[model samples]
Target: IDLETYIYWSGDIGRQFAEALAERARAAVKVHVLIDWIGSRKVDSRDLAMMREAGVEVEKYNPLVWFNLARLNHRDHRKLLIVDGEIGFIGGAGLADIWQGNADAPNHWRDTQFRLEGPAVGQMQAAFMDNWTKTTGRVLDNEDYFPELRPAGDHYAQVFFSSPRDGTETVRLMYLLAIAAAQKNIRLSASYFVPGALTTEELVDASKRGVNVEIIVPGAKTDVPIARYASRSKWGPLLKAGIKIYEYEPTMYHCKVMIVDDVWVTVGSANFDNRSFRLNDEANLNVYSAEFAAEQARAFEEDKTSAKLISYKEWKNRGLCTKLLERILAPFRSQL
Candidate 1:
């Protein structure tokens, strides 16, 4: 199994997984891990040493140094797990205690993780190798990493990967094209809901055209208050165009998913914010299957049960302090 995570914070959950992976390595199971240096700063050196003692192949992504200071803003924010080049997992959930407990608990994030099978797993593995090669300068092209895969499901999926160094924002362009082509409805669940001007305009236009456009975003329980405010500041334009906005009330909503017309579904790490679109490296899976889209649509409906619909009247009647905060933080939306 090959795993990549952004944050591996020090905690019982982190230690437990590290120990489990070490046990697998001791049993002659091939285990390789890649973690971001900045994101996993809290991981103790002793823990890494123990993994190395167990013969687990581990590497850090882009260690911070004076020479690489300029690349600090670019982060490998992808979470992937590929098992024997057959099964794959990807999404926003990281390896930390925050994701272990109930979402209702304080500091416990509500996120989504996905499992992929069939030929799409190969693309997921390739995405992981793309970063692995850049970080370690070692190309992994063995049959174990890229085995022949057969169709295990009735769906067509495409993996879209984006990075700042790629000279183009592929993930962002994917979202733009999907939203632009949406016909019946567009259901989006965004942990961070700051969309660019063109994207926002397209969404509003979709709503104006009588397409059911709804978005689920974080509420008061969000960890990043400034980002929440920035997201709220952009709600006016969307609401005026008859777009429906809902905030999940049970916990911090950390899922990045989108479904269009009950036939197209996207699930992965890229959020609707500018940071994900322009700065961070992200990977998303676009599935073209009515059955899969129906499943995701059901999840969206279940989430809506815990969400509070934000009406245009309510947004207009917000308190003065709230409006001022949104205005104050709007300028920094790009950075957030």
Candidate 2:
């Protein structure tokens, strides 16, 4: 199990999650947990001690040390859970109070998690090992971790990951290529929707080419206020190009999913902002199947019902103080 944020709060939900893993460890399960040090800052030491005492190998990624100060901005944002090298799960969720209940209220966030099997599960395990190896200088490269995988379904799926360490714009290029190749429509649901100038241009071009470009983002329930400000400031061009943007009204929309032309679907931890595309370690599962894409489209349409469309006029008439805050955050857009 690997997560960005694993808050060990004093809530029943938190206790249940921590104890579940500890129980697994006590049952002689080789439970290895990796969490981002900064992201899991709210986690209690006693909870970690309890897990460690149960024989769970827990490690924090990129702890603040003197030698690691230079790369502090880059974080491991991937959420992965691989059980016994068989089933795997990946999405944009953390172990926190906000993720306790279903998205029936404002406090519970709206998110998505995919439980997958087959060869894709092997790729997901590889993605986990990519970080597990980096966090601990040992590799788990045996049959217990990498066993023979059979096809679970007829979907053509593959997992790809990107990092600043590679000095390549992999996730960004993937989004651009998908946008550039979009023919019928592009339904994008991002929690953080601060697309930089280049991506904005690509989206605008897609909109101009008659692609029904629709995006869903968090509205008033956003955790990153500055990211929302920066995102709104750049929506003028997209709105002008006839791209439809909707802000979720119920709660925090923490889903990072994209569907193109009802044929391709990519979902995982990568957001539509520069922070996810450039600075953070991200991973996405790409599926080239129309059947799976249709299912995701159904979910997107349902979420759209709970979203409020923001017109171009509304965006233009935002308060002067809000505009000033956006301008102040413009220079730091890449870091958002």
Candidate 3:
């Protein structure tokens, strides 16, 4: 329920979904709503009021306290929606009013989510149930909460959850393992470029070893200017190591995707930044099918046409004052 993972689909799309979901709920579709207190603090009160009146059981995960710094860092960064517990939506996408635009509508905020209908739905529900227990301090063993979900589509999938709470090195190690398993090329597009040292080193080393590694990030303006500048400082290392870099010329790029050797693709709210890996509670899907990887790779190739390549020569010429600033923040990347 953090504000960052909201779905933006205004106009007819927004009105239609609101009516549809409300009707289904009224007809006895069990609804389980979970929001992060810290992230959703700025969320409008009117929406919560409406959901409450509609009988949707809404609860906030980890309402932040000034003293619990550790608790505050571990946010429920996952944005998931399961309709009928059969059809599930997971990724950075949220069900907030506006999520759809006309196809090729040039949506500024690029995002990705998979409409999953399989055994994975049960796993998704279980993940939510675990979080629900952690925050609510009560186990939810009710069968109604977790329906006997079955696969309605022909797709093989797995749920990969990440967080500091899970382990000290799982997310970081998992990322590197995915990279190591790649055979051809890697395409990564993220909102923030900052990363853990091992990941930062792995990316450069991958390119140096002749792997086709390409990174697409925000050009100059984005939701977080500090992160943009922080990324610029590291471009020199990545470029020298032979990794190609590009800046999306259009609206702020925010999609976090990794397509590797046409086998695995990582899609979720987890940015390739330090905070996402070491701090926040993140949920992502590591799809192992070649077909799914191809579709995602096609989208990356299409985006490449619009993004501008940032050459190493251009970065070296930036004034010393700005370069100094990026260097100052680069060391503290993990804390961001």
Each prediction's TM-score versus the true structure: 0.96, 0.96, 0.88
Model 2: weakest 10-residue lDDT segment is 1-10
Better of 1 and 2 by lDDT: 1
> lDDT of candidate 3 vs native?
0.70
Please give the CA lDDT of all the candidate structures.
0.88, 0.87, 0.70
Give the local distance difference test score of model 1: 0.88
Candidate structures ordered by lDDT, highest first: 1, 2, 3
Residue 85, candidate 2: alpha-carbon lDDT: 88
Off by over 4 Å in 2: 1-10
What is the C-alpha RMSD, rounded to one decimal, of candidate 1?
Answer: 1.5
Give residue 254's lDDT in candidate 3 (0 to 100).
70
The segments of candidate 1 whose C-alpha lies over 4 angstroms from its true place after superposition are 101-107
Clashing pairs in 3: 8-98, 8-99, 9-98, 9-99
Q: Alpha carbon lDDT of residue 196, candidate 1?
A: 74
lDDT of 1 by residue, 146-244 (tens): 999999978999777888888778888888999989989999999999977898999999998878999999999888889988888888899999999
Alpha carbon lDDT of residue 260, candidate 1?
95
